[model samples]
Target: MSTPDTLAFRFFSLHVVRTRRLGPSLVRVTFAGDDLAHFHSGGRDQSLSLFIPAEGRTEPGVPVEEGENWWQAWREQPDGVRAVMRSYTLRALRREPDEIDIDFVLHGVGPDAAVPAGPASRWAARAKAGDRVQLIGPAVTDNRAIRFRPPEGTDLVLMWGDETALPALLACVEALPAGTPVRAWVEVSDAGDVQQVSTPADAEVTWLVRDESCAEGSPMALGAIKQAELPPAAKPYVWIAGESGCVKTLRRHFVGERGIERRQVTFVGYWRRGLTEEQLRELPED
Candidate 1:
C-alpha cells in the first residue's frame, strides 16, 4: 500500500550529461533523463532541489514513492544513505523529449557561503558525461498570485548578488527583454570568479572584488548601487540576493526608505551567513 505521505507528483532520474565552467565560480550541469519529459516549464525563477548520489553509489538515487507511506519513507531513510541534496534555481528548462539543463552556482570556499560542499559542487568539479544525479523538486508555490516576470517598461534593471546567487543572476540575464536597459553588480572573492553571461538587453556590468581582506557583509555592492543614478521614473526593478542581513538592509534602502514599490523589487535570502541550508529552512519568515 502506498504511504499516505507519498506525493502524487511525477519524479525522474537524470544523468549529468555535460558540465561547463561559465565563470570562475559558476558551473552549469546539463542533465538528461526520461523523467524530465513531463516537466512543466514556465517557472522562470523557481527553485528546485537536486539529489546527488553519495560518493561511490552506482545505482540512481530514489525519490520518495507516492502514497501515504511516502512521508514515512522520507522520514525513514536508511542510515548512511549516500545522498546529498542541495537547493538551486531552475536556470533554464528547455524540453527536448528526455533532456533538461539545470545550472548550479559553484560556491567555493567562502566564510559567507556557509552551506557545506555537496554533490552539486563535487559533480560540477569532476562529473563526466555518464554520471547521474536525481532531481527532487520544482517545489510549487501555492500562491499563484506571486509570479515572477521581467518587469515591462523598465528603463533599467539592477541586479546584485554574491556567489551564492550567481545562478539566478545568470538566469535573469538570459530571460531579459531585448534592448531593455540593465546593469549588474556582482561581488566575488577575486578576478578568478568572473563569468560570462549573455543578455539580450543592453547592460553595463561591473564586478566587485574582495581581495582577501573584506568581510562577508561589506558594503561594496551596496555602495555601487547607491552611487548609481537611474533614469527618472524608469520603473527599474531591483533584484538582490545573498547573505540574509545584507539583503534585508538593501531591501530597506530600495523599497522602504527609497519609496520604491514592493512589487518593483525582489529580494531573496539565498543562504544565511552562519546557518546550514537545513537550519535556514527552519528559520521564521520575516
Candidate 2:
C-alpha cells in the first residue's frame, strides 16, 4: 500500500520488450507483462515507481509479496544490492495487448550533454529486449499519485514543465477535451529535444530551448511566461512540474503575481536540482 491512503498500489514484475529513440533526449521503452491486464492507469499524467538494478545486475531486488510492507523491505536491503528506484510518467498505455510506454529523458548524450547520465537514463540508453525490472504501481484508477485533477467548470488550462516533466505534460495535453483552451510552455535542453505532439484542444505550445548552462534550472521559461499573452479565461487550471525550486518559483508567480487563486493550481516537484529523488522524498512536510 502507499502512504496516507492505500490506493491499489501493487508490485509487479515487468520486462522490456522494445526500445526506441523518440527525439534527441527522449527514449521510449515499452514493457509488457502477464499481469498488465490487472493494471489500471488513469492515463493523463499517471506515474509509477520503477526499480532498476545497478550495473551488471539484471533483476531488481524489491519485494513483491510484502503488500503494505513492500517499501520497508526494499529500503532495508543492502545498499549495494538494492535497485535504484525512480518515478516516471506513463507516456502511452495500450489496453488491448497489455503494454505500457514510458519515455525517459537522456541527459548525458542524446538530448542532454555537458553532464553525466543518471541511473534511469543510463538504463534506458543501454536497455535491450528481455531486461526485467520491478514496479510498484496501481491496479486501480483512483490512486493518489495522479495529480492532474482539473476541477469541474474549468475554462482554460495553463501548464509549464521541463524535459523531465515533458512526457506527463504532453500526455495531459493530448488528453484534453476537444475545443478546450490550453496554453503550455515546455523547456528542453535543445532544439533536438523538441517533438511533435497532437492534441484536440485549442492548444498553443511555446517550446523553450535551453543552452547547456541553463539546461537544468534556468529562469528562461519563467521570463517567457511573464511576457506571454494568455488567452481570455477566468477559471484557468494550471499545472506545473519539474525541478523543485523552479516549480515553487512558478507557483509563486502564478499565485502572487498573476493573481490566480492558489487552490486553482496543482503543482508537483517531480525532482529537484542538486538532489536525488530519495533526498527530495525525505524532506519534512510543512
Candidate 3:
C-alpha cells in the first residue's frame, strides 16, 4: 500500500496507459491511475522516483511503511525481489484523464547500438499498456523537486540540457512567459532525436547532435556556448542539466568565466556518464 513519504510527497500506484516513440532515442510513456487525483506538481523539472517491477515480475515489490523509514525497508529487500527504482521527470500532465507523460531516453537499445541499455531503458522500450509501476511524486504544487526556479528580476534565461534532460528543458521553455528572452541548447544522441518545441517566449534554441560531432563521454555544448554571443542582460538565470561532468563544466563557465552569481545558476546532474543512479547515490557529494 502507498503511504506518505513526506508532507509534500506521497506514493502513487499507476499503470501504463500507452507508449509512443517520439524518435529513435526517445519514447513517451503515459500513466494513469485513480491515485493520481491527489498528485500535483509545479511541472518544470519535477522529479519523481519511479519503481518498476524486477525482471520476470509483473508488479514491483516495495515495502509499505509510514514516515521516512521506508527507504531503509526498501533497501533491505532482496535484490531479485526488490523493485528497480529510477528517477524521471514529468513531461506532461492532463487533468481530464488524470494522466501524466514521462519521456524515456532509449539509450543503446538496438542491436547495433554502441552502448548497452540499462534496466529502465529496456523496460521502457518494451513497455505496454497495463504495466504496473509505482511513483513517489508531489502531492502539492510547488514542491522541492521542481528545480527550474528563476528568481525575481531575471532579465534573461539561459538553458542547456542533454538528451536525458530534453523533456524537462522543453517543459520549462514552454512555461516561460511571452516576450521573455531566452537562449537554450540541447544535445541528443542523433539528429532524429531533435524535438519541436513550442514556446511563447522569444527563445533561441540550438540542437547539438552527438552523432555528428561529440564523441561519447565528451561535452558537446561547452564549445558552442563558449563561442555564443548572447544578448546583453543585467540579470540572467541559467538552468543546466545532463551528464554530471558536463553540467559541472558549464556551471563553472557561467559563474567563474561569465561572472554570473553562483546563486543565479541552477545546475543538476540528471545522470553520470559511467554510473547508474544507484551507484551514483552511493558516492559522497562534492
Model 2 Cα lDDT, one tens digit per residue, 189-252: 7687788979999999999987656554658988999998887777988999998888999999
| Among all candidates shown, the one with the greatest lDDT | 3
- Cα lDDT tens digits for candidate 1, 197-259: 787888777888855455647488778778877666658788888778888888888886667
Q: Residue 28 CA error for candidate 2 (Å)?
A: 0.6
lDDT, candidate 3, residue 200? 95
* lDDT order of candidates, top first: 3, 2, 1
Q: Report the C-alpha displacement of residue 124, candidate 3, in angstroms.
A: 0.2
Off by over 4 Å in 2: 1-7, 110-112, 214-216
Number of colliding residue pairs in model 2: 2
lDDT of each: 0.67, 0.85, 0.89
Q: Output the number of the TM-score-best candidate.
A: 3
* Cand. 2 Cα-lDDT: 0.85
**Candidate 3 local lDDT, 1-286, one digit each (tens):** 2344478998899999999999999999999999999998976899988999998899988775535677778888898889999989999988988999999999779998888898899999999999999899999998878899999999999999998899899999999999999999998877888889899999999998874434545456888899999899999999999889889989999999999999999999989977999899888887
